[model samples]
Target: MFIREITHWFARRSFQNRIFLLILFTSTIVMLAITWYLTDITKERLHYQVGQRALIQAMQISAMPELVEAVEAHDLPRIKALIDPMRSFSDATYITVGNEKGQRLYHVNPNEIGKYMEGGDSDDALYNAKSYVSVRKGSLGSSLRGKSPIQDSTGKVIGIVSVGYTLEQLESWLNLQISSLLFPMALLLLVLLYCARRFSLHIKKQMLNMEPQQLSQLLIQQSVLFESVFEGLIAIDSQHRITAINQTARRLLNLSQPESELIGYAIHHIVLPEAFFYDAPQKNKKDEIVTFNQMKVIASRMAVIIDNQPQGWVISFRNKDDINTLSLQLSQVRQYADNLRAVQHEHRNLISTIAGLLFLKRYDNALALIQQQSESHQKVLDFISHNFRDHHLAGLLIGKYYRAKELGLELIFDPSSFVEHLPSSLSHNEWISIVGNLLDNAYNTTLLNREGSRQIECLINSEGNEVIIEVADQGCGIDENIRQHIFERGVTTHNNGDHGIGLWLVHSYVKQANGDIIVDNNNPFGTIFTLYIPFTREE
Candidate 1:
């Protein structure tokens, strides 16, 4: 339970604090262990050195000829006189001279003279003439003593010499050594703690000061957002190596390799055109058309910046075909709105005319006008509905008829025109773009000639192996110089910027369906557009 509490406490701290505490704890443990080991070693060495010094001093006193002769003659005064000066000059706490009978003849204390050695440890030195060091309690109480035997001319042991250092004195010396060592050890520990703190702070800064859990959650959210975008996205490092690529990018690029295999590959190794990589790093480029894997795309390049520093680039793109489809759909909606407005205006005019005839009491004329208007609208609706099976195509023609009437031009469908169904070779929208753009072009062109027939003719036939559409308008003919490039983007007879895309889209869709288009000069004046598309049965 205590350990669990400690773990919880540690876990509650901030990341930087936790790192600091862990480092400090580990370093402190290591330093303490080293200090303890050194202290033990120092203590043992100090004791060994002290004992050796005492032994050497005892040996020197025992070897003195005058001390040995005095002990042999059993002369207490001579022994005391010979040892006093030596004892006063030495570091040993006490020195004593003892006869062969284990009775002290000379001592640092006068009372200790003539007394038997209190430690009873002089047997070996007095009888066997051995010199050694020992820890024993004597008149001076617990001391480390070195004893040496005195020998006469015959080599017989005559007396003993003892040199002693008290435990108190040894302890004082050890304390002095330890105090010197401790100061540096404490300084080293403080330095280690300071370094650990700096290291922890550095680590925290690198992590952006966020916890690990927060970073993990952020990563998960970013991954979801990165993959959820509709546009294809790719990120590359400064070295032009792929760092990240979304699934949409892989699909758009027609790459079958897994994302894991694509990462770290050089960006140039992918199927992007050279233009995407050139002048890409120095500045951002947007909405530039470039071919990727042989497919044209509207792409944008942006530099990835962090902390006001350039890291790499992020490129986003979408297929141009997708953009064209969206544009076509929006155009169709606008056309529908325009047709509704025209129908409303035409009805309002008819209503006002009928009301005026009623006010004048001309009932027969009002009835005739109503019948004529109904028949005209019903005839065109019936023709479109009965001939074109696809509702979208029928509706498009009906809307175009109303739009043409509003523009003061006649929109006539060829009597021989019949369309059962569009083939599966092209989407309905593509077919719509082709047929709608042609009729719209005819409408615009015929309106240019105020003195002409002001009529546009359309023919759609799908009864054979191919689908054929022809639109002829009695308007100014196409210019000889620009007829060749009329299908190219940004080529238009009108001065408006928006006038060029319709024909280009029509040409693009036709080519994508593997179809052919022919432009011809109509008789007298105007232009004719004919499209032939091969039909394939839907599986």
Candidate 2:
């Protein structure tokens, strides 16, 4: 239960705090263990050295010829004179000389000279003639002493010599040794703790100061946002390997593999244009038309940068067909509005003429003028409504007719023009873009030739196995140098920046439908654009 509580408390701390505390705890334990081990070793070595010193002192004093002679003759004054000076110069706590019967002969304290030695440990030295060290309770206190037996020339044990250090003195020396190491050990421990703290903080900064739980939550949020977006999104690493791909991207690219299977694969495997990957532009490229998996897409690219370094790239794209559909709808609405405005303006002029005629009492001329205007409008409307089955295509033609008239150009539809239905191979929007762009180009071209006939002719026929559309304008013909590349993007005969896209779009739609286009010089200074698109009937 106590362990569980400690774990819970530690788990609640921040990442840096947890790391610091763990390192500090481990370092402290190791330092303590080391200090304990060193202290034990130092104490043992000091004890061994002190014991040897005492033993050596006893052996030296026992071997002295003067002490031996004094002990053998039982000369107290001589033994006193010899041992007293040695005791005063020695570091031993006490020194004593005793007879074989355990009677004290000489001592550091004079009063104890006549009395027997206090400790009973002298039996080994007197009886066995042994030189050894022992710990015993003596008159002074518990002490560590070394004893040596003194023998005369006959090898008879006559007296014993003992040199000792008290336990209290040994303890004091040991404490002094331990204090010496403690200071440096503590300093090293403080340095270790400081380094651990610094390392922990560096780790925390690398994690952006966010906890594991927060990072996990952020990852989940990013995943949700990535998948929920409408545009197709793909992320590649610096090595050009796929790191992330959303469902929309898979669908747009017509990939059936799951995201897991797709990830880590080379980005080139999906066959996106090289512009998105190789030698990428520093600035973000947006709304670029690129081909992917044989399908046109409006794509955008942005490099992923972190810490002032390029990490990878993120690409977002949508199918071009989808965008084109929307553009076509808007264009149709605008054309409808323009057509209404043009028709209104034409009616106002006719009304003014009819009013003038009626005011002058020319009733016959006014009625004739009204009849002629009605017939002309009705003929064109009836022809378009009867021949064309697709309302959008017919409406586009009617709007273009009025638009051309407003621009002071005569737009004529061939009498034999007929379209039973739109081609099944191409979308309605694709057809609309082709026809509208061609008519608009023709109108613009015809208006440019002020010295020539301002007439634009259009023919659309879908009776055969393929659909045919032709738009010829009486304008300055294509330049000899540019005629081969006339349908290419950014190639325009007009002096305006926006003049190039219309013909390019027309050519793209034609190519997409497996159609062929021909550009030729029309008679008497003009240009003709003809398109033939193959059609298949849907069962």
Candidate 3:
């Protein structure tokens, strides 16, 4: 349970903190293990080295003629004399000479001379004529001892020569070895820990100091939001190849099929302008209309920057259908507001005129004037409402009527103008675009004409799956040269820097609906634009 708790606590730490702790723990364990291993090896190697030296000394002393002669003569003093020089050179703690019967003949400690040796290794050297090394307790305490045979001329062992190092002496040498090994090992471990800490800090900075779990959760949320967005989103690499695309993007780009996957595909092949993917300057483009698969979309693009350099581009877009729908709704609201303002202004003037007439005791005049004005207004409203059966179309005409009057311009409907129960192929929004722009254009043109000629005429009729519309204005007619590009965008007679997008929009809508438009400017009075839009919707 304690171990499990430690693991859980460590997992909760930030990435850099965990890394630092991990490196410190592992290095400590490894260094400690190495220290232990080296210490053990040093002890064993030093013991072996001391044993070999002692064995060599013992062998040399055993083969000495002085020692052999002394042992044959039983001269203990001479045996001690011969062995003393070799034993002092070998650094052994104690040296002894023993007879075949285990009687100590010569000893470093004189009290032990002529006494029986207690160790078994010295007996093995004498009786078996063998060299032996072992650790045993002796007069000098626990010691590493080596024994060699003292043989006679007949090759039979006569005695034994023994050399031993006391445990205290071995320990002094082992301690020195351990100090030497530990100093360098400790230095290396310190250096390793310092480097590990530096590396951990670097990693922490790169990871924004966030924990792995936090980063993982953020990634999951980003993925969910990206996929769930309604706007089409696409990410492209510097090479202009598609890197990422959301589901909405796939549908908008017509990549719904399995084989139509856009990942790794070049953006050029996808039909967007190359300028949109250019790498220079890394500026963003917003709300740019681009056509793909006969569908219009408003696209926005921004460069993805990393470390102050451009990595890729991200493009997002919305379908033009939705954009147009919103635009139509706003247009309808604005039109109603304009009409309301105009009605309010006109009613205020009429009320003031009636009040003045009634205050002067001209009751009959005020009543007759009110009846005339009401009948005139009701007649026009009834005619438009009865002829144009669609409520939206009727509303648009009513709004336009008041709007024209507000500008002090007479708006006249052709006597033959009539439309009833149009099919669904002609959307209400499309009708607004067609009727609104045409009437607006005519009104603006008439504003340029003389006061007497400030009049706009509108005509509308339906004929078997088709609708015909005509708007004529008694304004200055168009120039023959201007007629050629009059329907193009940015071509305008207005010098106020306003573009001529109205006609272009009308032309585009007519062509998109598979309709036709004819401009008649041959008349000296004004220009007349006639349009025929089919009621059959394009598939």
Scored by TM-score, the top model is: 2
Model 3 lDDT tens row, 1-539: 99999999998887887898999999999999988898898899999999998888888888988788898888877876777776667678988888888788877788888788775556577667989788988776888988998888889888888888999999999998888887799899989889899999988776777777878898799878978999988888878888877888878877754423667888777745555566353777666555655567767889888788878889898898898889888998898898899899888899999999989999999999999989989998998998898888899999999889889888899888889865454468867778998898888777887743777889998845688899998777788888888877677766676758778778777776678999996255778999987776542
- Tens-digit lDDT string for candidate 1 (77-182): 8887887888778999999888888888888889877889988889999888889999999889899999999898898988888999999899899889989998
Measured over all alpha carbons after superposition, the RMSD of each candidate to the real structure, in angstroms, is 11.8, 9.2, 10.9
For model 2, the local distance difference test gives 0.88
lDDT of each: 0.87, 0.88, 0.82
| Residue 313, candidate 3: alpha-carbon lDDT | 89
Q: How many backbone clashes does candidate 1 have?
A: 0
Reference-based lDDT, residue 272, model 2: 60
What TM-score does candidate 1 reach? 0.56
Cα deviation of 334, candidate 1, in Å: 9.0
lDDT of 2 at 412: 91
Candidate 2 lDDT over residue span 218-283, tens digit each: 999999999999999999887888999999999988899999999999998875656556655456
lDDT of 3: 0.82
**Predictions ranked by lDDT, top down?**
2, 1, 3
Clashes of each: 0, 0, 0
